[model samples]
Target: MTKKYAIIDTGGKQLRVEPGRFYDIHPFTSMGLNFLKPNTKISLCRVLLICEGSNINLGHPWIRNAIVRGRVLHPCFDKKKIIAKIDSKHKTRKELGYRQNLIRFIVDSIWSNGKELVS
Candidate 1:
């Protein structure tokens, strides 16, 4: 049977997630990372909508009780890289560096279409 699914918004982006799948999410600061602890059960409360069979449900603000659960697989940072620029025009110059602390998760299950499927 074709499984039903939902799309959720986290960290300002949309993710098409399914159970048993591992995916990366946007990085967060150390202080803000508490919300994404490893092995933590998080319900994606900001569901944009859901699809089951041929039926679709869209939320104005967010889907009510539309929960997608996932476990944090790991919390880590991406490789760092230098961002630099130099211009001889009026001696303009700029340099910067950045690294992102991303969260990896394994979707455990999704509750929708009046049912739950574990992956």
Candidate 2:
């Protein structure tokens, strides 16, 4: 049998998702502290497409009755990345480091056409 999956759009990116899988996604970190807590349930209704077995449902932008649900596993910052700049004539160099926060989500289920699929 063919595997069931769905494509979702979030944070300006698209992701292929299956049930019961965990993914790390950009949280669009804000200036202040985030209010999302661990184990909290989250729903993403921006499903772009859904594929079940050999059947495919496409949406102009987003499917009307498709939704993907997940649990917030954690919200944390990834490893720091460094940015450096060097000036030859000035003989000066500078370096900066930054960490971007990300959200960890474990997909719980996917619903399409009023039917739910849980992996």
Candidate 3:
């Protein structure tokens, strides 16, 4: 299996990820209300770094030969979240709730240096 690196953009954030590794991505809803489905395939167009074995290539805007592939595992929310409000003098208190949509992806491959990793 060939080894390579790829850069991907998720939820307006760019990430450098690899295969066999898992990463947290922003909720699909963040993209737009149109994207509310779970476990959907979304292409990440931002390529930043591609490292293959010993050869490494970097993108000016994006590496010409780098491509990263990933799969959306599931749609969920963070385990721990907190929202609170308080007023000291008035002794008033309020609390808010939050549960953000999150996606877990498994890096399928990082194509760079004219090579691709086996899935």
Candidate 4:
């Protein structure tokens, strides 16, 4: 059997996802989905494309009735990013650090057209 995978849009970004794998993603704040508790079930419906073996399915913007289900692992902070600015002529230096909040989840299943693919 062929493994199924999909491309999905989340938090203004596109991600290629596969079932049974864990991924970190930016929380959807507009939908009030930040800081979700661990083990919570989440469903992503903005499927851009789906591929299985030699067959492929595409969406105009998003495929209707296509869903990817996952289980939340935890809320965590991403790696720190540092920015430094220096003006040697003036003997001035500035630095800044930033880290983004993210949620980790493991994909459980992909469903479309009444068919379910579980990893």
CA deviation > 4 Å runs, candidate 3: 1-3, 28-39
Q: Of 1 and 4, which scores higher on TM-score?
A: 4
lDDT, candidate 2, 1-119, per-residue tens = 57889999977899999998898888743422266678888788999999888789999999998999898888878899999999999999999999987888899899987889643
Q: Which number leads on lDDT?
A: 4
**Candidate 2, overall lDDT?**
0.85
How far residue 67's Cα lies from its native spot in candidate 2, in Å, is: 0.3
Q: Please report, as a residue range, the 10-residue window in candidate 1 with the lowest summed lDDT.
A: 27-36
- The TM-scores of all predictions, comma-separated, are 0.75, 0.88, 0.73, 0.91
lDDT of each: 0.77, 0.85, 0.69, 0.89
Question: Which number leads on TM-score?
Answer: 4
Which has the better TM-score: candidate 1, or candidate 2?
A: 2
Instruction: Report the Cα lDDT for residue 42, model 3.
Output: 57
lDDT of 4 by residue, 5-101 (tens): 9999998999999998999999877544454888989999999999888778999999889999999999888999999999999999999999998
What is candidate 4's CA lDDT for residue 35?
A: 44
Model 3: lDDT equals 0.69
Candidate 4, clashing residue pairs? Answer: none
Model 1 per-residue lDDT tens digits across residues 2-25 = 667778888889988777888888
| RMSD of each candidate relative to the true structure | 3.1, 2.2, 3.3, 1.7
